[model samples]
Target: MKAKSESLTAKQTIFYLLLSILLNSSGNGLTVSLNMGSALWTASSVNLSHLLNFDLKPLLVIYGVIVVITNTLLLGRIEPRRIINNFLFMVPFGYLVGWTSQLFNLLPLNQLSTPLKMLLDCFGILMVSAACSIYQRVNILLHPNDDFMQIIRFKFFHGNSTVAMWVSFVPPIIVSIICIIISRQIYAINVGTAFSLLFQGSLIGLADKIIFPSLKHHGVEQAVN
Candidate 1:
């Protein structure tokens, strides 16, 4: 009886881990695909000369590689139950929010009106929350030196989890703000550009916030049950 029970538990654990790995891989695939598609569409929007001048492929490849490495590290330390189930829920949700943002202008809103902008903000929160959740599920591995920032927060500040997260995000947030301003001024970023930016932001948020924590909680709940 003990041997059989142990065997069953082992099977269940493996199943959960595999499911998490699959979910992260597929979810990232979907996200990277969508972002690349959006960027390519942007590339198509301008003149050929301008398009040639703008080099995004290198950036794309870097982010892609980072995603893989981060996933590998995080997955190595954690079970799938900590990441998969939440991703299963939030990946689609983030995609939906992105789609909605990308289409809000087309849905009879007058050029980023107050109401439409408010709606975008609301959805943006939803997207960020979703991403943060996803990240929380993942352990250890992180993209683009963010883990280093987290460590700094932990070591120097003796910060709480929330503070650590906010501290880690500040640099990226500042960079993003600068990029958005430049995109608007230099690139003449239109409604679509704006939407894509928000979409991408929310995509990350969904992974980091919404799905990650949800998965962790689900795993804990399952263990308790």
Candidate 2:
């Protein structure tokens, strides 16, 4: 009876979480679209588009290598379902996130404007975190980018002892420093970007805590157990 109760509870939680994820992702998409529209309407009046020409290859290459390496390490150990799920979330989000960042730079505002910067940053962070939550709730694979750190925490460090969120930035943080050294790119590694990253890590974590419990209740925990 007790076991059955827990299972039921988990299912309920998962349903609610997934719904929230969907709504949040929709909001993020709409926000991005509207922002782009605003940019297009004002294109002729502003010169901020130059910021979009930033040479971000080095940063992207370094980050991509980390994700690929981590995914390779956990290829066979983790469920393939989680991998696929992550890919679905990360790819679309990655594309938009990149585009959003570029558009963000093109917005007719000063990055040096402290208040505006923070406001724009909050919006970015909220979007990332929201997508991360949705991705995890859909019964899909964990995104490859986060796979390595999450595996280490859950497998080696004991997840409850240390959350994967804190460690998620290690690879990127290192890469960001390298980016700063090689270029004068304003978006190289700013607070706005960091805030967005923190959301990405935290929301997936929220999903894990919320959705996985339900899965475990439904018997998905058998493999991890």
Candidate 3:
């Protein structure tokens, strides 16, 4: 039973936006480098990269572009500001994930014990969950996949984060299935994928209450528009 969400000021929006992007990229990078698994959308991109023998970074960018199109369809309107905001989020996020992954790859994650790796993976997911809570509240510029979830959360599911998260996963699940059909293999779908599917939304909702209880969703209309 949280109180009503108040709007974010411009400076607060920018602060959360930057902080969330950093945390999100770092979390994604850890999962990528650890190779335990990733969130389904990221896993789908990895699967598609393997299937097409394409570079993962560019493939990720392309994947974001596709999600942008899907979101546009869902919104049923073409808002250039919203479109540009998503792209702005895409580029830096892609670069940061790549850079962080490469940095972490220099470590000896492979030699780590299984339980330790699992702990690390869970930590990464937590970082992502926290980031989602922050940025989704700020609602300035967001990763397209996050934007998808936000739209579903507010528009269709009546601000039910968990339902929206699960529903938002439909596209990636389809993409992964298509890749498996074509390649007879899977990529990046494993323990982390299961963890995310089960708890990411719940964790995000929890974070809103515990992490920054004062922060609330801002500019929600932009999500539908």
TM-score of each: 0.36, 0.54, 0.93
Q: List candidate 1 stretches off by more than 4 Å.
A: 1-112, 140-159, 173-225
lDDT by residue for model 2 (142-222), tens: 445544544554555555312555565555555444544554442323444545444555555665566444433123233
Clashes of each: 21, 5, 0
lDDT at position 53, candidate 2:
46
Question: How does residue 63 of candidate 2 score in lDDT?
Answer: 43
Candidate 2 Cα errors over 4 Å, as ranges: 1-66, 75-86, 102-113, 157-162, 184-188, 193-225
Return the candidate ranking by lDDT, descending. 3, 2, 1
Cα-based lDDT for every prediction: 0.36, 0.43, 0.86
Q: After superposition, how far is residue 104 of candidate 1 from its true place, in Å?
A: 6.3
TM-score for predicted model 1 compared with the true structure: 0.36
Write the residue-wise lDDT of candidate 1 on 1-225 in tens digits. Answer: 001111224554454444443343333323222322222122222222133354333332333344334533633554355245434433443344334434443444344565554444434333333433343334222323333333433444442344545444444344444654555422323343344334543344345444423233222222211
Candidate 3 Cα errors over 4 Å, as ranges: 1-10
